[model samples]
Target: MQGTSYYIPAAAMAAALAFKVPSLVRAWRDPLLRAVCALLAMAGLVFFFAAPPTIAKVNRLTGVTNFSAPLVYALLSGFSASCLVLLVNWRGGPAERTRRISRRWIAGYGVHIVLLVVLFALGDTPVERLRDLDTYYANTPYIREMIVLYLTGVTVAGMTMNFLCWRWALQVHGWLRTGLLIIMLGYTFNTAYGAAKFAAVFARWAGKDWDALSTDLAPILASLGAQISAVGFCLPLVCQRLADTWHIWASYRQLGPLWRELDKIAPAHVRAVGNLWWSSAELSLTRRESDIHDGLLSLHPYFDHDVHARALAAAVAAGTDPEQAQAMADAAMVVSAVRARVADPEGKLLKSSDTAESATAEGTRDLVRISAVLREAPVAAAASGHAAMPESEVH
Candidate 1:
């Protein structure tokens, strides 16, 4: 408890530098996420520092000379900090799928962690067997008491967290919940070992000649349990984050400025003139506008060539009734084009109309929003006709 436990904080901080420092830069992008991650990192730093004193107290209570306390305090401190980051960023609104997943995870982990802490506060220990050292240290009573507390706490906590983790797994293909469960497992087995040790400690105190459990079993089980669980949870969370970040990056590349993209395709949108008897050339112009809008959509950062082809295919699939599909495809292109245009700053193109609504470029983004939508993908599927259904229908 005394020699080098306190010094480990320095090492912990050094290790945390990579994780905590860059979070400062990231915090600026999303104040909530960065703040949470950074704060947690700092908490992790504090955790290592607090370890020595806490462990020293345990050593005093157990009276075991070469005694060890599982690194639960350090882990819990860091994990709680991380939860702050994750909890703050939970999603909102009607499509509550992601938020629900996170909530389940949070609730599960929170319950288990609280129980674990309470058990520790009650002075749990893992020692099952007494050596001469146990007699000398007088570690049995308090340690045994803690074991009983921990077992009760973990039984409740682990089950709750595990269920939440299971729910999250069902919703998404990520391991955020998995990671949490793994860590919870650490508490589970650690508690089990402590429970076993509790029986041992109790038997020894009774002095009935029954073979009591020993302290040796508790620490080994706790350490291995914690390590495996923590790694199980952390590895997946890290991997999931990496994958999500990569997807965002890839999507950002093609989108460009949404306004600029819109402007590029703006002129192509057919003006909904009241008169139906327009000249053939006029009708052709409307068609040209539709084509340009569709082309502009291809410029969108997130748009892939496959989407365009699929829209075209839908038109064919619609058979003789292609209007819906074609119109939808065209409208989708217009919308994508508009988004790309808006995303661009340098183009700064404007939208104007020959009507009263087109007078000034105010709220420029809204100029043809409704009309453009009428000309594009999902919605226009009915307009594209059956021959082109395959290309126009959304996959």
Candidate 2:
């Protein structure tokens, strides 16, 4: 059961690669995550092909062995490094030393890995006496000693990563954030076991009492740890998928009301972007009365009178870059203390989109929707709870 538990995180990690990769790429856009996965892939190749001989050698004795031992350590190392990067990025001003933080992280993990290798070479292996696991340990005393050390590292990094995730969850308000934090918590708890197992090994080295931390005590602890980790690993991806489904469902649910509301005066607001879709990939929404409700929410960002006017004015200004046009209006409104349309780093109005092209499109579409709402005086009046006079009646 304990052995099985260790694989839980491995499986969860695998599932995330399979299911959450696309979303992760889309949402987080963290290069470190991609690098981590790539490193895992490379390490797997080495483990199966090159490291077998080293593993065999270590298997022969119960003391120590191999540069390959860093594989598990690598998980924590990458995590620790990534967390530090995020922290640095979060705290650093525009003038802060960006390269310095990165260099420090690399140098730190590298030193740790080197010391571990040297320590592995010089440990007292009990290969002959350590049969079964005892036999494996017998050939490489260094391996035995390092096991506890490596696990401790895992624990330290895991704790740090999980805490970082928890804090991040606090910043973002949504189900996705909650799900990810839960997963992080789970992994942290499980990693503690892996860490403890390593600690136990170290204790044995300090004193020759191996039986004190046996399959009985260790396995149960390991098993419980695995359970937490396994759930943590798998759940974020699962919940993310589930959350997406619910989001789409909720969007569609609001479609009927949106359609009824927009249908009142002009389909101009509805048909402003005649060619563009709400979602070009999954749900193609082109019609005023079709699957377009999902796209309409972008207009919500500019529902207020001043926001609606500025956004529409931005659209009418006729610039080569629609994003720049939105930014122009967004800036004007910000100074006037008008609340609407979030600006991106470039001082352009933007949305959180997967693609650069889409980000601009979202910005343009937002203002367009606002354009729809305020094209005529009656429409603006309706939005503000005034008795809306029909365009023909006014004429």
Candidate 3:
């Protein structure tokens, strides 16, 4: 179970780093992205080194028994520092204050790193007990202090992160807030991991054996916390991208009625850009909007002011809100114009009006609303009937 836990987070952090590499390369100057990449790298290192097989290999290679102990501690200290810096960069306050806070965290963690190295050097452990190092050296002088110091530093960092995430979660909204709350939960587990380890060490000092807390239980907590934290950090970015894609696809589908009507009247205006079946929603929507504008421009001569006025009155009589009624009226005018253009392509050109200008405007919210009205409004059917009549037959 411990092995599985370690490998899972290690794989996840590696995948996250791989996913962000392209963005990091494209925006190398983006401090927040750079911080995120660094955090993932450090987290990956922590999990990679925490595995017992890796620890034994490192101890064997370094010719110092249990060298992986200090190495893992140092990597974990660096990971904590990276998390703090990433948070600072992400929150984004005054530039000078951010730099100062980041510098202080780095310096403080640097001291922890130095302390870990010095204590590891001072301790004497001939046996390479990769998994049971803490229990083995529970009573040893320098080794005991070394374990306690690392635990203290980890606990402090975890507590600070939990507080920061919880406080910030209250101020944000949407996926960001949800992500922060998840991060806080992860950090809560991290703090528990530290507390468990500390309890084991304190038990040793009090002449009791609670070794399982450090040797077995704490590691599980660490692994669970690390994996959850990685997912939490990634959640907002992934969710936001999904949301944007959904909005684009929704807009494309909503604009279908308006796009199809205009295309029938002015098929020549449609520009073939790519395979319609394979095109992305954003690209398809952009092309559809461009084609709609061109088609509307071609039908400007068929725009009837009286048709628009009557549609507005009808929409109002139906108890639609003023803003929505306006959109319905605009949609009615567009449908009527398309029918008139098809009925008589050589009809006299109507002079440019505000309605024409607004109808043809690129990527406006009003256009989307009007497109929706065209899909379901009764005013559109009435306007189509008026447009279907010949000029001599209409009053």
Q: Output the better candidate (1/2) by TM-score.
A: 2
lDDT of candidate 3 over 1-395, digit per residue (tens): 45666777788889989999999999998889999999999999899889987887898898888889999999989999999999889889998899899999999999999998899889888888877788779789799889988888899999999888888988999999988888888888899999988888888889999989988899889887887887788899799999999999998888888887777765443434422888887888898788877777776656677776777787789898998987776777777777666656554444333344644332243767877777774656765654343554221
**Candidate 2 C-alpha error for residue 95, in Å:** 12
Q: State which candidate has the highest lDDT.
A: 3
Name the best candidate (by TM-score): 3
lDDT head-to-head 1 vs 3, winner? 3
Q: Estimate each model's TM-score.
A: 0.41, 0.47, 0.87
RMSD of each: 14.3, 13.2, 3.5
lDDT of 2 at 361: 27
Query: What global local distance difference test value does model 2 have?
Result: 0.45
lDDT of the candidates, in the order given: 0.44, 0.45, 0.81
Reference-based TM-score, model 2: 0.47
Instruction: Give the Å shift of residue 142 in candidate 2.
Output: 5.9
Could you give candidate 2's per-residue lDDT for residues 1-395 as a string of tens digits? Answer: 33234444445446545664675667674544544454334323322322234345554463333334444345445554554554445333453375576567767766766666666667654332221242245235566555555555556656665776677777765554755566576555546556445545555556655543533354455445434543543455567787777766554443433343444322455546543434532253224334233333332332333543555464455442565444334323222221222222221332432232321223433433334344434434433332222223211
lDDT assessment of candidate 1: 0.44
Candidate 1 per-residue lDDT, tens place, 1-395, comes to 23244345435445655665676675666644554455345434434433445555556677753343323433443354354334335322343554555556557655555554554555534443222223222344453444444344444444444454555556655466566556556656755654655555556677633233434555456445544654654577588778766665433322223233344544443334312444443354444444434444333333333444565576567562454444444444444434444454344332321223311112112323334434344453332232132322222
Clash count (model 1, backbone only): 94
